[model samples]
Target: MRHDLRPGRLVAGLALILTAVVYFGDAGDAWQSPWWVAFPLVGGGLVVAGVVGVIARSARRRPESTPPADRNRAT
Candidate 1:
């Protein structure tokens, strides 16, 4: 099986999982954090993911330079 790894999706999924964990912890009274923290976390995660995706796309679109072949080679 072949699989492709997407950095943006990975980051976004991690962010969502973290947010859920935070909420779960709060609900279970394990620890307490500002309720607004999740907003920033999720927002920042998405922004970072977007930037990463843009960079990856640009990198993929860039042309790769190959070495020039020798001109004096015998046929």
Candidate 2:
């Protein structure tokens, strides 16, 4: 139920919107930049963002329990 807009999904959505514009608006000819280029470019960006997001999220996550020896030392 976590509906957060993570980096990967956000990139995917943006890419999809751009694809619609390129294909439906006939922007391909206007831009003269191969429409197919969007897929790989967006895909790569998505991967990079996903990796960075994961690394950041994990770093921000709450720390696990203290070391086992500390735990056994009891209060």
Candidate 3:
């Protein structure tokens, strides 16, 4: 089956992965950062917002199922 395309999810996943890589790579270094902590927070928020957006978008659309041929058209 084809997967749903959502930029939010993609962005969040990538951001989190990048964060992990950078955080781990700098483990040996003594450098510290205050603004660097925002990466994970943004990633988490993106994921939540993406899921909510997908749910809302789907909910707003009409169902695609059609009536069977045997069903009467005239009332």
lDDT by residue (tens digit), candidate 3, 1-75: 786566556667776776665666567474554556766567676777688668867875555675664354543
Clashing pairs in 2: none
* Cα TM-score of candidate 3: 0.41
Per-residue error for 43 in candidate 1, Å, reads 0.3
RMSD versus native structure for model 1 = 7.8
Q: How accurate locally is residue 31 in candidate 1, as Cα lDDT from 0 to 100?
A: 95
Models ranked on lDDT: 1, 2, 3
Residue 52 lDDT (model 3): 68
Per-candidate TM-scores read 0.73, 0.48, 0.41
Which pairs of residues collide in model 3?
A: none
lDDT at 10 for candidate 3? 64
Rank ordering of all candidates by TM-score, starting from the highest: 1, 2, 3
lDDT of 1: 0.82
2 against 3, candidate with superior lDDT:
2
Q: Which segments of candidate 1 are over 4 A away from where they belong? A: 62-75
Scanning candidate 2 in windows of ten residues, the lowest lDDT window is: 24-33
- Predictions in order: lDDT: 0.82, 0.66, 0.65
Among these predicted structures, which one has the highest lDDT? 1
Each prediction's number of clashing residue pairs? 0, 0, 0
Model 3 regions lying over 4 Å from their true place: 28-75
